[model samples]
Target chain A: MAAHNTVATSNARKQVAAGGWLWGAVRRNGAGYLFLAPWLIGFFCLTLGPALVSLYLSFTNYDLLTTPEFVGMQNYVRMATADPKFIASIRVTLLYVALSVPLKLAFALAVAMVLNRGMRGLPFYRAIFYLPSLLGTSVAIAVLWRQLFAADGMVNSLLAQFGVEGPSWISNPNYSLYTLVVLSVWQFGSPMIIFLAGLRQIPVDMYEAASLDGASPARQFFRITLPLLSPVIFFNVVIQTIEAFKAFTPAFIISGGSGGPINSTLFYTLYLYQEAFSYFRMGYASALAWVLVVLIAVFTAFSFLTTKYWVHYDD
Target chain B: MTDAVHEVPGRASTHPRLTGTVRHVLLIAISFVMIYPILWMLSGSLRPADELFGGDAGLMPSQVTLQAYSDGWFGLQVTFGRFFANSLIIAVLATVGNVLAASLVAFAFARLKFSGQKFWFALMLGTLMLPYHVTLIPQYVMFRSLGWVNTWWPLILPKYFAVDAFFIFLMVQFFRGIPRELDDAARMDGCSPWRIYRKIILPLSMPVLATAAIFSFIWTWEDFFGPLIYISEMSQYTVQLGLRSFIDSSGTSSWNELFAMSLLSLVPIFLIFLFFQRLLIEGIATTGMKR
Candidate 1:
C-alpha cells in the first residue's frame, strides 16, 4: 500500500509539471495565434495570395482567353502616358471623392445632432435617415437616381414649377457628376449612425454643466461636443474617404455603365471595371488596382499619423 | 467636454434662439424635403406608361392601379419573381454564411490561444485596407479557371473563407465582451468546447449575429457589381442586374417601366429596414467596443 501511494504521488507530480510547462507555452504564445487563425487563413487564401497574383498579372498581357504573355512594364507605361480615359476617370473620381466625403461627414453630423435633440420617435427618424445609406449603393436606388435625374423626369418637372429649367442630369456631362455626388451624400446614414453612437458616449453631464454655465448651445457644441467627438469623426472621415474612393455602383448604374456623356462620371473603379471587363485590358486594370491600393493605404496611414493632434480616446 | 464641464450656466436661456415652435416647424420642413424624392419615386411608380409624362405630375397617381407592379412582377424575360428569389437566396445564404463563418473565426480569435496571432490579425486587417479592385481581375481569373463563372459559387464561396474581415473583427470584439468565467464553468461541467459554443456563446451572441446577418443581406442584395461581372446568363441574374436590362442602351429607354421596377425592387429592402432598423442601429452602435 505504501509503495502504491508513493507511485501515485510521483505520477501526480509529473502531471502537474507537464501541465505547468504547457501553460507556460500558452501564456507565452498560444492565445494570440489561436485567435488569429481565421483571419490568417482568410488573409492568405483570399487576400495575400490573390494580391501577389494580381501583381504578377499586372506585368503580363493576359486576357481571360489567352495565355498570359509577359508584357513587362508596358501596361504601366500605357496607362501613365497614353490612356485618355484613365486620366479622365482619375480626375472625375478625385472630384467625386473629395466632394462626397466631406459633404457626407457634414450631413451625417448634422443629422446626428438633430436626432440627438430628445425628439419623439428618434428611432423612427433614424431609421428613415438610414434607409438611403442601406439602399444607397444598391441598384434600386441607382435605377431610381436615373429615373429621377432623366430629362422630363420628376426632378426637372418639379423645377419647371418655378419657371426653372433643369438639364438632363444623368445624361448631361456637365451635371451627371453632381447626380453621382448627390447619390453618395444621400447614403450618409452609416456615418450618422456612427456619430450618434459617439454622441451617446459623451457624458451628458458635460452638456448639463455647460447649460448651467450659460454657455450657448453652439458654444457647448464647439467646445465640448466637437473635441470629444473628434475620435469618432476621425474614424468616420477615414472610412468615408475610402468608401468614396471605392464608389462604383452609382456611377456605373446612373451613367448607364458607359460612364457616358463623354465619361464625365467615370469613377476610378468603374473605369477599372471597364478596362478589365469591357476593354479586356486586364494588365492595365491590374496596374490601376495596385495604384488604388497604394492610394488608399497612403491616405489611411496619413489619417492615423495625423490623428494624434485631434482624436481623444479616454484610456 | 472638459470645457463644457466648467460653463457659466446663467446666460444660455437669455440668448434668442430657435424657440420650440420654430424648431418644430423647421424640423418638419427639412423632413419633408428629405422624404420628397422617395415620395416622388413612389408616386412615379404608380403612373401609367404614357401618363408618366403626358399628364401634369401629381403627388398621387390619378389612376391608381397595380398594373405596373403586376407588369414588373409578371413581365417577360426578367420577371420579378425569379429576381426576388435569386435575391432572397443570395441574401439569405450569404448572410448565414457570413454570420456563421465570421462568428466561428471570431471565436477562435477571441478565445483560443494560438501562435503568430498579431501578424495574422494585421494581415486580416490589411485586407480591409486593400481596394477590392486590386483583387478583382485575379479573382475573376480564379473563378474562370474553376468554371465558377455564371454561377452563385463565385458570389458565395469566398464568403465561406471569411472574405470580409470587418465583420469577423466586429464579431470578435463582441465575443470578447463575454465573461470568460462562463467558459471556465462549462469546462468544469465537462462540456466540450463545441458544446459550450453551441449552448452558451451563440445564444448570447444573438444581437451581434443578427446585425451581421442584416448587414450581409443588405450588402449582398445591393451588390450589382458582382452579379454584373460573374453572372452572364439571363436566367441567373440577380434583381439588381436584372433591372439593368430594362434600360435599353441604344435609344430612348422605358422610363415608366424602369421607375415601376425600381420602386418594386426597393420594397423588400425597405421593408427589412423598417422592421429591423433598431436591431441594425444597435448592432452598429455596440460593435467594436472593448466590452
Candidate 2:
C-alpha cells in the first residue's frame, strides 16, 4: 500500500513537471508568439483551410445553393475529353505564355540596356516607361485598349494616313489575342527596371576589356552580357509567365467578359471566372483552379531544376 | 584623330557628338511613343464626341470641353462620386491593416528568437508563390456563408490578417538590415518587446512602411476581382466596377464620357506615383535585388 502511494505521488509529480515545461516555453517565447498571432491565424484559417477545402470541393458537385455531392474524377474527365472550351483555353493560354513572356522580356532587356548607358535625364525616361505598367491592369487602360484597337479608332486613323486599311483588332478572332499580347508587351517597364538594376551590378571593366579585345558590340553582348544577365532573365521569365497565365482584367474588359470572338481571347482565368461566377459551376471551377495550381507548381519546379544549366551565380 | 580618341575612350569608330545626338533623338522618340496613348486618351476625354474618332490621330483637341467630365460624374445609376468614396474607404482600411500586421510579423521574424521560427518563415515564403486561385473558391464560399457577399468586409478583412505575404517579406528584408544592437539596448532599458517594436523599430522603418502602404492602397483601389466577385450592388461598387458598368450600361454611345471617367479614375494613382516615385523605385530595386 505504501509503495502504491509513492507511485501515485511520482505520477502526479511527473504530470506537474510536464505542465511546467509547457508553461515555461510559453513564457520564454510569449512575445514572439504574440507578434506572430495574426499571421498564424491568417495562415491557417484563410490560406491552408481554404486550400484543403478547395481540394475537396474540386472532386464534388457543388453550387452555392446545394450541399456538395462527391462525383469522383468526373470533372477532370470532362475537362479533358468533353469540354472543347477547356481545350481551347489551355491552347490560348499556352500560346499567350509562350509569346508574351519572351517578347516582353526581350523588349525590357533592350530598353534597359539603352537606359543603363549613363544618359542624361534617366529618371524622367524611367518614370515615363514605368507609368504604363502601373496603369496597365486598371479597367481604364483596358477600356482605352478596346477603343484604340477598334476599326474606326485612333490606330486605324494612323494606319489610314499610311494608306493601309486595318481591321478592328479587338473583334477579329485571328488578331484578338495578339492585341492582348501587345498590351502585355507595352507594360515592359517593371521588368525593365529590374533588368536595369541587374545591369548595374555587372562591372564596367568587363565591357572595357571586351572593347580593347576588339570584340564587336553584338559579339560582346552575346558573350558577356547574356551570360551575366541569365539569372535576372530567369527570374523575369518565371515571374512574367505566372503573371501572364493569370491575366484576367484586360481580357475580361476587352472581350466584354464574354471571352468571345469565337472564344479566341479565352484566357484560362477568365474561363474559370465564367464557370464559377457566371455559370455557378463551383465544383468545375474548383477543378480548373487546381489544374492551374498544378501547372504553376510544375512550371516553377521546372524553372528551378533547369537553373543549373543556364542561371549563373557569383558564388 | 587624337582629339577624337581622347574625347571617348572606347568609341574610336564614331564621333562622340554624333553618337550622343543619335542616342538623345532615339530616347526622345521612344518616350513620345510610350506616352502617346495616354496623351490621346486625355485629349479624347476633352474633345467633343463627334471629333473623337476617324480624325487625324493627334494629341490636341480641336475644342476642349469639360462636358464629358460632368456627364461621366453623373453617368451611371450611382454617381462616380459614390464609387470613388467606396474605393477610398476600402483602400485606406486595407493599407492600414497591411502595414500594421505585416510590420508586426516582420519584427518577430527579424528580431525575436523562438522555436519553429525558421519553419513558420519558410511557410510564409511558400505562400508567396502559391496561386490565389486555389484558395479563391473556398474563401468565396466561406464569406458567402457568413453573408459577406454583398459587403466590403470580404475585401477588407483578409488584409488585417497579413495574407499579403509580399509585404511581410518586403518588411522582413528591410528589418533585417537594421542593427540588432538597437534592439538589445532597448531591452536593457526594461522595455517590453512591443515597446521596442513601437519605439525603436517602427520609427526607423517609415520608408518601408510607406512603400508597403502605398502599394497596398494602389492594389486595393485597382482590384476588380475581389469587388467584382463580392459586391454586386451598384451602390457598393468600386471605381473599377463602376468603370466596367459604364461600358456595359452606356454601351458605345458615351465614349467621351467613358474616357473622362477613366482618366479621373487614374488621377489618384498618378498623384501617388508623382509624389512617391523615389520610394516606389527604391522599393522595387531593393526587393527585386534581394530576391
Scanning candidate 1 chain A in windows of ten residues, the lowest lDDT window is: A30-39
State the weakest 10-residue window (summed lDDT) of model 1 chain B.
B7-16
List DockQ for all candidates. 0.45, 0.62
lDDT of each: 0.79, 0.91
lDDT of 2 by residue, A111-212 (tens): 898888687888998998888888878999999999889887889999999999999898999999999999998998889989998999899999888977
Show model 1 residue runs off by greater than 4 Å. A1-41, A211-214, A313-315, B1-18, B54-57, B249-253, B288-291
State the fnat of candidate 1 relative to the true structure: 0.56
- Candidate 1 on B19-92: residue-level lDDT in tens? 54555566577667667778877777777765746224457877776666776665547577898899889888
Per-residue lDDT of B146-237 in model 2, one digit per residue for the tens?
Answer: 99999999999999999989999999999999999999998888999999899999999999999999989888988999999999999999
Clashing pairs in 2: none
- The local lDDT score (0 to 100) that residue A135 gets in candidate 1 is 71
lDDT of 1 at A20: 98
The TM-score obtained by model 1 is 0.89
Q: Global lDDT for candidate 2?
A: 0.91
For every candidate, C-alpha RMSD to the true structure in Å: 5.7, 2.2
